[model samples]
Target: MVSAWETWVRRLVTRRPGVPAPAVAEATDPAGTRLVGAPEPVSRLLVVRPDTVALLTAAGTDPQLRRPGDLLVPPLLSPGAPPVTARAVSTAAVDLDVTVTDLLTFDGHAVDRAVLGVLVQLDDRDWYAELLELAAGHADDLEEYLLAAVHRELTTAVRGAVRMNRLADLQRLTLAAVLQDRWLPARLGAGTLRCLRTRVQRVRWPGEDEPTVPVRPPPAPAAPEPPPQPTGPDQSVPAGST
Candidate 1:
């Protein structure tokens, strides 16, 4: 196999204004800059926006590094440029669709039909740490990482509630009632993702246009079984004599 990374010096990747402002973004096209601080030979550099932080895996020694005001010597990790992870201090809204199922009952209820709409906010403070935890030392992709975690949390909460109660209760239950005080402030690893808005978007029951079919009305009540019963006994005996 052939290698493409030529390790000679360090580089920087900065988030300029007016670009796609994702909370955490990969620095694919890093901009080259003068060695900011220590003469550490890094494969690449990521200079994030104000109030934003970048995780430079292939650079400087101090683990408690904050910014480039003090550029120290960077370690030389040679083969290729390690991908830089940077996140601006901001919040992002993520919408999740979680399937609510009746776990305790074998009611043949749909496992996929009923869904709860979960609107969560990934704030500036917590998202990065949570991302790092979920990444588990792997490459970083914020959207992919976040949604997976959220979906898991939502499913757990919903199913837990469903197990205690019937699906019928869920049909009438409102997402707002559960979300604000109950499901909000979810702690996933070190990340804090809160439920911003939620709703029970779908249920397995019939819709307005397709309501419960009415029973056939007991065949119109048999047309008044009236006073004929009073004389019917004698009338039948007389017929036999004739």
Candidate 2:
């Protein structure tokens, strides 16, 4: 049966094939190495000495590292081995002390003897100090790029929100105006007629030469005449009545 340690090493190697086994050692070593932090996909490995910390790339090589600190230190495998240290004098070169520790610590992952065996086979090379300078500059550029991208996203969202709000407001105002117009009465001219008039009066037109004539009122009907007084009763009454 495969040991648990072997299985773990296999899994780690499979997950990140680009990461050399030695790099893993440097990452796991507690005394020799420490994980400063991982900013997303990039992991920063700090190689420490008695005095200062030397920053290494996530890939374990410092191509753009500063001068006098150009040497690459091999990973620690044995508990009894000496400790590893590095000194950077300029941007182009570096000096390092190599040591061994019984155990290493990295990002909470532990690597022991079996795992260290697979790591020591990897090689190390000196990286030019100018490479570190280039990397430093590139890091700044990346930050600016990311900041601009975030700004653009925020601006777009704000604009869309504003446009939607404006449309809703306009709709509300239009609805209000329509309701107001429907309920209000229309205005009328000064000479409009009413239905209850009992008379029709006519006035002469302006600038006419004819004298003004008064309109005549309809004549009152003559009072009904009273019947002729009855003839004296002495006279013989005629058969036909008047």
> How do all models score by TM-score?
0.45, 0.18
Candidate 2 to truth, TM: 0.18
List the candidate 2 regions with Cα displacement exceeding 4 Å.
1-138, 167-242
Which parts of model 1 are misplaced by more than 4 Å?
A: 1-47, 50-53, 59-90, 95-111, 123-136, 174-185, 188-192, 206-242
Per residue, candidate 1 scores C-alpha lDDT tens digits across 6-55 of 11110111112232333222432232211111112233443443333333
Clashes of each: 10, 27
RMSD of each: 20.0, 42.7
lDDT value, candidate 1, whole model: 0.41
- Residue range 27-74, candidate 2, lDDT tens digits: 322222211112112122333322222433434343223222233444
What is residue 149's positional error in candidate 1, in angstroms? 1.6
